[model samples]
Target: MSSELLHDSGLIANPASTATLSDADADSLIAELALRGRAAQRVLAGMGEQVKADALRHAAAALRAAAPRVLAENARDLDKGRANGLAPAMLDRLKLDDARLDSIASALEAVANLPDPVGQVIDQRTVPTGLELSRVRVPIGLIGIIYESRPNVTADAAALCLRSGNAVLLRGGTEAVHSNHAIHAALVAGLEQAGVPADVVQLLPTQDRAAVGGMLRAAGLIDMIVPRGGKGLVARVQADARVPVLAHLDGICHTYVHSAADPVMARSVTLNAKMRRTGICGAMETLLIDASFPEASSVVAGLIDAGCELRGDARAQAIDPRIGKASAEDWDTEYLDSILSVAVVDGPEAALAHIARHSSGHTDAIITGDAAAAERFLTEVDSAIVMVNASTQFADGGEFGLGAEIGIATGRLHARGPVALEGLTTYKWQVRGTGQARA
Candidate 1:
């Protein structure tokens, strides 16, 4: 599409050099979005949970049926990503196959089975004066998502937002532009075929950084901005966005082995945390072991056996002489690769202290047989998601029974953990009174 067409239609301002929408265009789009969102909210609020579930099941089936066409378009994105010198990790994220498509569809079906989080009153009360008050779950109106090269996010985010009755405007990374567009098209088709508003789920239609800038400047147009990517992207969005942004920053997650940790459980959990899809944000970047623990050496050796390249401090290197000396920068790094940084601390206190100083406050885990230490870490650690015996990979919403997730929220305000259906909504006061005066 030409810049003139995009700018003239008020969907974007310039499509040539920057492909960004202007303030005027953003306002127009947002107004339309709000209308659609309100309409969806009304329709969904009155809908039975079973009917909503049926729509979701139908959408999932449609996605499976459209796999061949989707994969064909996805290959174009993968080729483009490679031609543009994108990282192998990013290219892998952009690529899609029938299996991945089926997974996405299965995820949709899972979400359909989850209890609807909308319009459910969380709490209710009646005052002595006979005034009734209730806190209910309601759609957040409109949301703007800025994400990276994951095409599954396109379907997952759309499904979660639609199920919650919120309209979303997604701006996926340029590497998966073609794939994202195709997936969004399929989702829109599914929604329309189900008699839902197509505008409830929309894409930015371009792959320009300036378009992200335009989205950031869209203050009144967008209700909230949810960014799902690296630290650099999250920092930029948080700094420049005019709207309230839900930050899903880097996952500098940690797994600390307490003195009382069972060696067998610790070894298995730590290896899985670091090696199972190291490219994912929830993957462990650092491993902390108690200096007093007798089995620390064997645990470090186990990690190495799992194909993890060990980078450690002097203390760690002394225990595992094969490890390279870890640099100062390694402590704070989220090495989304095969490398794992190992450190030896005095006890649970020291481990928690180290994590509090360097963690991204995303997900952290403690492998311990002692109930006291586990309770301490669970209470003291300020991360959004903390685990006792599970791997950090369990930070995902799907694992938490939300079916799918837009992303993992590292922020601590309105939404903290997973961006599920409830996370897509905001509560509002609904008041009804007869002709009664306050006085």
Candidate 2:
């Protein structure tokens, strides 16, 4: 295909194209992209909600229509990843198949169908000064998303940003370079067909690591930086970014089984949480079992039987001789694999204490028949998401019914938990006053 195919506008003329640029050139390129993104953002913010929705729907259709191309490109990325000795867990995150493509398209369609959050009145009243006061939702304007190994993010993040009336600059990982190129082309084609500005969703043309630094330093141009990856990436973004960061830090998620928990639910939730696509951040890494629970031994055995490697403390090892001794570091590790850290807590207090010390504040779950215990856990666990009797795997924006997530925010700020379209927005207070001054 010709690079001129998408060259009509600044919509990533060629995503697979890269250059060995000096630091000066990279900074210049990022600044130019940011300026273009801001221009497109203004146009999108003024568009009717229905118009934006239509464009996203078109994008979804385009993605489906281009499935063959997308899948082929994904295969190329997978081959390179295998050749480079990428870890198994990361390879899974990078790989894309027909079913996953369908899911990605479906998520785009779902975001289109969601209620447009832009311009909605969050609060309204007549103030004492005779001014009509209202707080209305507005886009966060020109967001830069830095993510790794997840090609689907190229679609999901763009859809959510457009739906919320913001422009986005995507800097995807090199591991999924070919896949990102194919996906971005389809999405841009659909948006352009529906009369949206091509620059509304821009992708960096190159995969150079220096471009990431340019994005990090783009404070005025990019309103916010959202980092969606492992702890290392998030930590770097948090440390180096001049732009405000809504960080998705380590998903050191925990699942606690109280003594009153049913054996069947404990087994089922634990197995699924750890084993069902363990590469995701929401996958449970720590299992806190109440020592007094009658089926504690069975729970540990079941995990090991399912090929999950368990690292546990002395007490946990007592439950199962097969369990390996957990190092102190194991308590805080975010193992995005079929490995788990287990702790045998004497009671709810012990479990809570362990979670408090080690939890990454992503998502924590409690399994119990006792309402009091469940309620207390919900109240006390200060993570972005707290669950009751559900797999931590369900800690997803799509699962929570917002179509798809831009990212799961582990921070305690404007956008926490599963960051969907609504989370991509902030609010501005509007006051309608007629010749009314301050008293």
Candidate 3:
């Protein structure tokens, strides 16, 4: 609650504002948010599972009820995006329709239906010293979510944190600020109606970007920071944050077709993996084809026919004259668009080797009929999510049946892969002993 606490925590008070508010105002804003978030989290942690579930249900209902307003706000964001020359892929992520709005509300209900993670016993044992010890899941209080572009993250992040019993401070990108405000209003309405503190989920009032620095440096206030955005934002958060960060970096995902891959299956899966919503983080950005695989041309043909722009290596260019030349940078790029980078490799080993060099460690898949090759690919590729004979598009939290994900963590520590409600919680050791003293 005090600004002096930052200095006391051995963290320098950062220059959080030179653009919007004065340093004093920025510090005050963060201090107030911290106090409110901590207060709400304490109350939320004591609530029973049913209470939290019911509140989430109420929030879902509120979102559905406020659909007209939410849609209207989304329209404003879309208009601004178009006028501001926002990229088509980014605009798609920001836009929401009737079905999408319903999906957002449905995600809240889905998370509500999930088993509560808090208070669940992770491990229990009795020691030789006659001490009963149990490790139980508990809320990681006051989480800060700093994300970009996707308005759906507002609803999803809020739902996951609330379901896990952690108070959240949401900082969405300025592109969807109006939409975020509308959704936040609906969420708050439901929380207040259900007798939950409105502070349980708070969106920052300013989008000056300096408040993010404030949040990053709020050591004792925010327990952890979950950054969901492009490489730039995630890298900046990781580099600058004084608190712990769960980083969701760029999705430079890959889809490899093994030498034994079925041509028909490869065509279907590769097309879907790359184009099924190119704006999403799970969409495959690179295609690695084993030179021994038959019908590499058709696999590239299917994608091209589907309006995908292909940038290929020399070998891949030989298959299709329409293909563009791929640069050295293409291998490392996360093309969250209709464009796909193509490369032809000699064998399964070469394909695997290519993926190893280019993958962002997010999600990678192998399509093959040979179990040995599939198994080897599955065992070798080091990624957050790996698949055999399946599309990388399936790399989603809801698809994994965790209800909804806060983010797909590229980081290895603590929470990895699709971060759901369980990922939002940590554990504490509870020991029961009587008449035991250290000797």
| Pairwise lDDT winner, candidates 1 and 2 | 2
The per-model lDDT (C-alpha) reads: 0.81, 0.91, 0.89
Question: lDDT at 205 for candidate 1?
Answer: 54
Clashes of each: 1, 0, 0
> Taking the tens digit of each residue's C-alpha lDDT, what string does model 3 give over 1-439?
2546444433232221124655565667787888998999899888888888888889999999999999999898899899999999999999999999999999999999999989899999999888999999999999999999888989898899999999999988888888988998899999888888999999887776767888888888899999988889988998989999999888999988888888999999999999889999999999998888889999999999999999999999999999999999999999899999999999887888888888999999998889988888889999999999888889999999998898889878998899998899999999999879877
Write the number of the candidate with greater TM-score, choosing between 1 and 2: 2
Consecutive 10-residue window with the lowest summed lDDT within model 2: 1-10
Candidate 1 lDDT (Cα, 0 to 1): 0.81
Model 2 alpha-carbon drift over 4 Å, by segment: 1-18
Question: Better model by TM-score, 1 or 3?
Answer: 3
Best-to-worst order by TM-score is 2, 3, 1
Which of the two candidates, 2 or 3, achieves a greater TM-score against the reference?
2
lDDT of 2 by residue, 181-202 (tens): 8999999999999999999999
* Candidate 1 per-residue C-alpha lDDT over 256-323 given as tens digits, one digit per residue, 9 for 90 to 100: 99889899998889989998888898999999989878888788888888888999988999987789
Question: Number of the top candidate by lDDT?
Answer: 2
Rank list by lDDT: 2, 3, 1
Which whole-number lDDT from 0 to 100 does residue 333 have in model 2? 93
Which residue pairs in candidate 1 collide? 13-21
